[model samples]
Target: MSTYFAILTQVGEAKLANAIALGQTLKLKKMGVGDGNGALPIPDRLQKALVHEVRRADLNQLAIDPANASQIIVEQVLPEDVGGWWLREIGIYDEAGDLCAVANCPPSYKPLMVEGSGRTQVVRVVLIVASTAAIELKIDPSVVLATRQYADDKAAGAVMAHEAKANPHPQYLSKIDGEAKIAAAIAALVDSSPETLNTLAELAEALGRDPHFATTIADALALKAPLDSPTFTGTPNAPTIPHGDNSARVVNARALAEATQGRAGVQGLSGANHGASPANKFTVSALAVTMRNPATGQAITKYATGALTADVAVVGANGRDQAAVIAGTASVHLHFIFNPATGVTALLWSASADAPTLPAGFSFFAYATTIRYQGANVI
Candidate 1:
């Protein structure tokens, strides 16, 4: 069983115990207030759906918190829709089924009661669910015998769904924040099965690699524009090009760092300045750039170590071959190209001035394949 479902079982046991021992009740809420169903309040089915989202903590038998074994119902959603899948708002109700909170993730409770009683006890409880959503399940396959057959490791669904709701394409644990979650998830999934474990490892690698789509979107949003032109070399190790920064240089650095965290930080940066009252620091990542020149004609420049340089003095408009990079002259058109696709006539995309520093394959913005599509039929 996945750690996710195992954890869910625990929560489920808690909820079941609370319902029986404390007699707490709950009601879930809908994403929007109303449509035409009068109150438009969340229906019990959806409430149960939210409840179902809770990972069942794997321990056998239900254990109720005697002190505060209160019934808790939770409904969850996202703060806003990002893309394909969206985690909606969550609703929590007390034993009496009253609104306790509306939030993305409700904080942990302090603790309700130490032990139970024939008299009464309010066992503190929490119902956790996803922030964004994709699909709903009426009958969870784990519990259902039919589903159990196909879902030997049912928890994959949760992790897969969550991963999908996140950045498109599988990513690796490269960034600081993503790495944390990936570590936790992978740890949880490791014992699931060898196959599952291997998949998780692959997921870790994917998450670690740069997703071109995400990179492109972030670049556009940073509002940082590349310099007018570049001087690239057909050489991979010593390509040279002219680079300059506008006033947005500093702001752009911060924005990019915020967007990509430190992965996109300036290179060749020194420590912060402690000389002044508050001191200052230098973020050179933004200043560093690799311009992707549109193809002028038919020519190829291989990316290598000696093909890159830090300064530019002159450039060759012929989009100089790889030889230009080895010399490292400033004024030149730098073309650092890597195409993620491996087919002939494949397109390419640029990350930094250097291409395929770590190569699985090439990078691409889009791919070409003949597909049939029907335009709006309404003519």
Candidate 2:
């Protein structure tokens, strides 16, 4: 029986020491098996390569033995890989393709499918080092095969990790803490609220189970008129203002006109004042006047007398010297016209006994009702 063990080579020791000194990892890359000429060969620390390389592949895994911190376990799975050969020795290589360790295993025969007998092999090598801190335990998962024991060990480790702490997922609240918090929140709400409407279900029921209630209220309010500069349509009515209460209130136009002297009225107005003897020129006394426009029904007022000049006369085509024309013509009618838009007065005379035609834009015309007989002039 040959003693099966692996030892680090001189180059491997130097690399491991350098890695430990620099606080770096020694990356192991590949594992190679050899036949050793159909005989079990002894491993030498001075060996730079395998005796007769049979097959080489990337290591499946590298690990530090939990039971022995100073031992390294290198593993490779030959799942339906190369066969029809004898395995006598094995070697481990670093990333630079340098043999780091060598070992001899018990003589075993690997068969191919053509030989009517094929089997998968798992080769493991354990190397004893002073410390495993410098050895990197990483492998390319794409090119490696996971064994059942490896998967089971990992699953067991995950379970142990989960059981070691109260909350394995730190992002979520624990069951105990969550239950206590929820209970406290419910107690706080119930304590501050009435018994009839304390729980969440009661609040939901009070809202009639309509999620769009707030939106419905907002839409209804949007149809209403705003307080500022509100506009109304149709026969919108308000409280009528009192008889004489002058405050902020709505009143009809007719009521407002009657209350504010917006009507046709005159003060200290004379019927007609003939100018002296033959009544050649007629004048009327000054009077305050208030009247309303017939076109727009808007009231206007003024405190001024009527003026009669050549520009306002209607005697002849030139409209000058109204007394001579009035004395010479028979049945001459004098007319007083008022412009409600400008509160100005004008005069016109017609010889045929009817009132003269009112000028353009003059609506109110004042004519004397009683024809005065003064010194044969019919003044």
Largest lDDT belongs to which candidate? 2
| Displacement of the residue 298 alpha carbon in candidate 2, Å | 99
Q: Pick the candidate with the highest TM-score.
A: 2
Off by over 4 Å in 1: 1-75, 79-97, 102-379
**lDDT, candidate 2, at 165:** 91
Candidate 2 C-alpha lDDT tens digits along 1-379: 5488788998888889899889998899899999998777888989998889899989988888889888989998877647889999999998899998999998888888888988889999998876698898547788888878899999999999999997678667778998898999989979999987987788889888778979978998988889999887777766646567788777776557546644455566664444452344455544765545544456555566654532223343113224453343345454455665675676555443333445566665444323443444545
Compared with the true structure, model 2 gives a TM-score of: 0.45
How far is each candidate from the true structure, as Cα RMSD in Å? 31.7, 28.0
Per-residue accuracy of model 1 over 1-379 as CA lDDT, tens digit each: 2211111233333444455465543222222111112222232322322422222211111123234343222222121111221222233333333333333321222212332212111112243332212112223224322223224545776777777775655564458877798888877777665763367457656566545757866887666444655443464243222133233333433333323322211223222212221111111112232222222212232322121221211222111223233222222212233342553112121123433122234332111111111221100
Q: Per-model C-alpha lDDT, please?
A: 0.29, 0.71
lDDT of 2: 0.71
Give the per-residue Cα lDDT of candidate 2 at 36: 94
Candidate 2 minimal-lDDT segment of 10 residues: 309-318
